[model samples]
Target: MLLSKASLEAACGRKTIRAAVPSLVSPFQLTVRSLPKQQTERRLVPMRRSKAVSVQNNFSILALDDDPIMISTLQAYFQRSGYHVDIENDPYRAIERIRKTHYDILLLDFLMTPICGDQVVEEIRKFNKELFIILLTGHKSMAPPIRTIRELDIQGYYEKSDRFDQLELLVESCAKSIRQMRTIHSYQNGLSAIVDALPAVYQLQSLEQLGGTLLETAAGLLHASSGYLFLKQSDETPAMHPQKDPELFCTFECTITKEQARAQYTATVFPDQKTIVQQNKMSAPLFDTRHSMIGMLHLVLPHAPQYEQVQLLDIFSRQAVVAVHNIQLHGLVRSKNNELTQVLGKLRDSYVDIVSVVRLMVDARDIYTRGHSDRVSKFSRRIAETMKLDRETCERVSLGGLFHDIGKIGVPDYILLKPDKLTFEEYNVIKRHPDEGADILAATSFFRDIVEIVRQHHERVDGKGYPRGLTGDKIFVEAKIITVADCFDAMVSDRQYRKGLGVSAAVHQLQQGRGTQFMPEAVDAFLSLLDKEHGKEVLSLYDTLPSTI
Candidate 1:
């Protein structure tokens, strides 16, 4: 259904109706200036004369209807109110335009040829859910059911009248809503970009990679056409020079040379602590962990950015500071690591000889305990290997096992070598060896990583055994492995006070102690090892060792 002739006459005076363009003329060809002087006089009325709609320059509208006059009136009124407006008489053409172009609000007529407004809305809802739509009907009764409107997400509906006061109010409400939605959408996108860019930034190992990643992420977030990143050369040196000039490290579609960026950094960005925006360009200072200026970032955006974009850029700049500082710290760590590696190489032989002498001294003091540390170290390493632990962990566990009983050196000879069963006081004295061993190893940086294992090797899974009553996962896995190996060897190896529990008895003890005194996984791995052919050989080797005092 098209606009009635009487309604058209009422909208524009009769003389203006006679001047209307031919229906065959395309709607796109019509403009406000082409309308008759009297037709243009019929302007849309505002809901409140003093409080008119405030439209943004980019806020736009698409008016779709079968009647040319109705489309013309809407276009003229919206354009006059400072909005960008387009009109389409064919629903198919309107739908195609909506698909290709972004319009903030759509003004749709309820009646049209071939298909109605509801059908057109259904087709559009298939692809675009964000477009704000308003249905215009000749009468309230002609409007689609409320259910259809809700399912299609139609934002508003209005009865067509001689004056467009109600329609104007609805458009104002939609414009405000669109502004908020766009702001939220932009914020979400900016946060997601920051999240995605940080992993790439931190993964970079070199200063060059760091600079490029920081520049790319900042530029992409700001939608800048080009940018330059300048970082301090002194960050690579052992001692930093705060006043030194920064070198340009990266450029993205940038025409400026290094000298130009350096000049801008010194003249424009260095003195100002706040971000500076001039027309289409922005300059933000890069800071270190101490909040000292370490560099500058310059970007050429497509237009002067909004307050929200500036805020997001500020956030990105703070994270970039962390990235830059991490890169500097990494460089220092790499240099120090090289020096330490060389020093450790020189001390390697001497360090081994000293540990060997200590082991011999501990064994020489007790005939029954001879070869005990070596056996424990080998057994612990085998358990670690059976558990598929890393090479470094296996090595650490072996070292830990070797030194696990070093604390017993501090015990009195009468107590350590006593052939009689230990009273409660002597047993209490025995419990202190783990702590003493941890202290001895902690004195050397070489044994730093294994100190916890040495300290907790006697700890029980049920929190019953120990220098410290650590339970379950609180015990280091390396410590747990050593605990299982140490307990097994102590149970099966001879001591002066009693006959050694034979291999079968020791296995029974281990099975009884599972979960109550030992980590279940460690026990399982060690038990699996004992079942192997090599494990039988290890047991035989233990049997061949001297058992006499």
Candidate 2:
């Protein structure tokens, strides 16, 4: 049915009256400002006025009516009722204006020439589902079906009448609903930002570093003024190792007394579950995937968080547990590695004692050299120290002296025990001892550095000595020190064939042999060691030979 001008005004209950328009032009397709003067001295009911005024001032209302006189009247009436209102006479142009402006309530006319209010609301819903809408009609017959109202998602409906009290009530009701939706959107945005930032905080490796960043970020995101992060202490004592224990930390905007913080800590259960407890203050427990408690966070905010926010904090707490566990694993691996290294050192020391016992058994075969190996070992160590050699080289030189004659165990008893002069074949058998000793020591990994010293101790600077006959620099520095110490001990010690050369004669022989048979530096160091305070004590200690077996 075609609607007339009178019929449209009858729907709105207004005449063809014009009010003075505002001088400014709005950027939207249609803009209706409040009239210069109010048209109705009538006020909303006292009960409605009190309720409407509370939220009416914050909302904006837009009306879509084809009658110009009806649009002007609504502009004046709604504005006087403490709402920001705009009106559109062209229903087609109203869509564009609504799209361009921000309105809390859209009051759409039910009857129009080309388009109805329900169709316009359906069109508006395509672009904006959040807009609160109300349908205005002249009669119930003109309104769409109940299904159509539900489909369009309209908030309320009002019949155009002289009172306009119902229309005012509709506008105020829609405003309250709009406020709730906006609050929900704000919370969703805040939650999305927290989820996005959590991965970066989880990337921290250090427990202290992760704890500090995590608590500060959680407190700020939760709108908390103060927070305490309490991680459980491990059973192990921190003083036994270098690493310190992880402590309870707090991130706060205000000062909290130590007594109060201690009280809060004591109140938390020993093993807390993933739950939030609220009484005078708010507390939440952090748990891992297994639901084991790792820590707890205490917060002080102006307002308490919703259930959804507590769920988010629980998620962050789980991530914190994983990070802490990773740090603990790293520390455990390092401690185990250090303990393994110390145990290996003790094992090596025990092996050295076994090698000394073997050397003593070989010396027993030749009673004249009962303490020969021990004396040579002491002399080699002292000479190495005087030369300022590194400790490892000195130790190898000393150990090599103990094992130098181990190959004599392989020689036949007849040749080794003969007091008479040896034949050329027997002397050649003696010269093979150095080579055999090196071969025996080479089989063991612990004697790697000592291998060269044992092999070349018979080598001479003049290249006239035995085994490989290695010359001057070809022999290792450690081998040279052992060579000088061995020669000095062998010369001064008694032999099975003749009496021993005394200290004076042995010193003179070493001096003459320097740079020819012995390394000049090694000889000089050995001679200097003999002049020290302990030289006489060391010589007297090995002066006697143990009785032959």
Candidate 3:
């Protein structure tokens, strides 16, 4: 049976145990009955309230008992002690109240009608294992089994008595325990967030970008107001630290040894921040698996870091090493790729210049052909542009035109500069120049794409031209443009023994040859190009060329 202070005094009249002042050695102490049956060692919990108790005053407590008197007593006492307290007289209703509200501690009466205190704790533990529990019972015999107390994680047992000092001490202890748990949980969450972001952070390819993100994440997770990252050239050599940026309020450049990197301790103040207020600092060395310490991440927090925070920063340092290695690898690959591109570009330019020089040298042998390849290159480019070819294709056509007659360099001077009509043997010898030009360029991989164009430039649509004359659609489109450009320039320009035919006559010759000697599409584009602004410039430039006598 439960009895309150007033009701017990009225029933027993100063003779009841509920109203008597308890005889004790201290304000709160465990009786010998608190000893567990399984162990001889008694668990001791010191409960002398500190002169300066720093526990959270707003902490909440839920007190449950079938006696409304007992519940009211606990609510009044804890409420006066600066805690938020809720009271419930039914065990089932207590479980429901706990489900709806969050409490730091639970005070439960051990003996109740319908449901005992152990059963109430069992139900609450199912949903709220974190709430600290203390049992209050009138009879030691009515207390739950020792196993039940341990299994339900009950923190204290207060035999019901007139004095509430023991229960108050238990509540204070629970508050301190809850505070410590929340502090540790906060550090765990910060570490989890940093771990989850590693995939994206390491994916950054640029050194500057990766460094900035890594330092920012590290400092932010540690609640630092300012920090700096220092990069080393190598593990043994001095680091090439950056000049202090205006952004960092604190910068630390002291080198950390391998032993220091492994230490999970945070200093109260780093050497660099000695002039400023003493604040917490975490330093981590970024080193690869090769044991090369390449950089360090230093963060300056406003206060001392917890043990968990220091340990988490150490883990971050190990991950940062791997991230820095990947950034360096990406940088190396990017540098090599750019170098290869520049070298290939220069080689291609020099190769084209060599082709032009060869054509000019060959043309120099005959006065009438000095600038013949140059004019052919300009006209071919105009035709390609009129056809709306891509820039690379247009440039390829121009290059093919410049080298189209390069094979003439192999012809004897007597046959090349005859200055008269050639016999069949001499004409046959001249017809081999296209094949010769292709063979000369075939040895270089750089000119592989243009070889077929150079070989087929002289072939005709009707298959009557030289060097594998079987043609039509078989001829490269670029080869067809070169053929039209070559013939058009030859007609309008001076030859060794004939006068220059004007643009109109040259265009008429192209119209007559369309679909038989030249590609119809190529001929149409070339004629259309002659009407445009650039084409008019080509026409006027050719008019200045020295004409036949």
Candidate 4:
């Protein structure tokens, strides 16, 4: 027979016993005699007060049983032991409640009407495998099979009895195990977060981006509510100098107000201060490879971090220091690159000035050819533009035209300035000017793009031209455009040898040479440019030049 609630309370004092009333039994009969002497003595021994407090704060338990008496007894007994206990008589409702709320341990009855204890365990196990479960049975024989217990991962089994000493002992054991497991899991998660944060920290190129990511990652690792990063910078002093004060680079906050974060920031001394782990607050110095402090990270955590959490924080701080160093190096490299680019631009302008002087010297040797290269340059650029060529190709063609006859500087004055038509030998000497021009310009990297254009401008589309007779597609498109421009300008401009051919005559010559002596595309593009207002203005420049030397 089961003892009445009044009798059970009187016998156990403040500690309640988890016992069940058998069906068809008289509730009035006291069953205190059924408890063994060993069990009775064990119940008299006091449990550790600190352990009970820890359990009450850190763990919660849910008691699920069909019998109201069984549920009430289990709740009273566990609650008296300083555990957060919730009781439910309906198994379905208990499963639903467990789904919504996280309970650390489950005190489940073995026998129920619709679903057995193993069935309930199966349902719970499908979604939650981490819950620590202890099954309570009316008798040893009524307990679930060992296979069912092992398969379902049920932690322990307790048979219902007059005394609750054994059940209490089992729960205490499980609680200790749970606390250890929780610690291990927390450490695992912290380590995983550190690993995940490393790549992002290292890959960021700018200080602002690195700072933001570092602060966020550090805050997340410690579960901090707010944080700020202070990066070291000095305008007149080295960053690692002992006298330099750290600068506040950036700040990040979550669930903390800016004013409060600012006040905390103001209160803390940086760079010189070592790592601090105080109640709800932590700050660590970031150091580079040289062991010099580069920055400081301060965080406002939710609680005092444990020793392991502080260790994790240290690991993360070391990694963040490397990230800070890398970003600083990247900034330095970018600054140097920009400086180099400016220097290169000045040098390039100097080279162009030198080339202009050389072109002037070439023109001075023959009065009739004065401004001849300039006209060809403008004409080539216009033709290139009309052909829908890219800007870079157009610029190359224009420069190539200006320098195409540069090798005339190498030609003998008597042969170059001759008033009559050149003999075959002199004509061959003129063809060599293209190769000589290419050789002269090839000495500078700046003019490399136009070297081929200068060399191949005289190449015929039919593979019948000089200085490496490259045909049609083999010749550079830029050179082909320059060929057409050079031919038109040479024919239309007056020379020491002959009067200038009119624009109509030059066009007729270009039409006659198309596809055989010149690229058809280049001829068509040049003719098209001649129809435009800009091209007509260019043509007018040649009209003002001397008709004869």
Of models 2 and 4, which has the larger lDDT?
4
The C-alpha stretches of model 3 lying farther than 4 A from their native spots are 1-63, 67-101, 104-188, 196-212, 225-279, 285-297, 300-303, 321-349, 364-370, 385-396, 407-477, 489-509, 525-549
Each candidate structure's TM-score, on Cα atoms with residue i matched to residue i, is 0.54, 0.50, 0.59, 0.73
Q: Please write out the lDDT profile of model 1 over residues 1-549, one tens digit for every residue.
A: 443533543444222101101121111111121233234335433322334454546788999988787788788777777789999989999999999999888898878877888899899999999888888766434668877877888887765654565566677778777877888889999999999988998884667778888898899898999999887654444422234434536899978888887777777744446677889888888877556677888889999988778778878888887887777677677778978988886686567577668777888798778888888898899889988999999999899889888888788898999989899999999889889878877766788898899999989999987888999899998999998888888888788888789778888888899998987877888888777666776787576568462
Number of clashes in every candidate structure? 0, 0, 0, 0
| Candidate-wise lDDT, in order | 0.77, 0.70, 0.72, 0.76
Name the lDDT of candidate 1: 0.77
- Residue pairs in clash, model 2: none
Name the 10 consecutive residues with the lowest summed lDDT in model 1: 16-25
- lDDT of each residue in 256-325, candidate 4, tens digit only: 5545545655566654445777787778876666665656688887788787787777788888877766
lDDT for 61 (candidate 1) = 96
Per-residue lDDT over 267-294 for candidate 3, one digit per residue giving the tens place of the 0 to 100 score: 3233422122224866666565666555
Ranking by lDDT: 1, 4, 3, 2
lDDT of 2 by residue, 143-210 (tens): 57767877888776665544565566566556666666666765676578667766766573566676
lDDT, model 3: 0.72
> By lDDT, who's the top model here?
1
Which 10-residue window of candidate 2 scores lowest in summed lDDT?
18-27
Task: Candidate 3: give the clashing pairs.
Answer: none
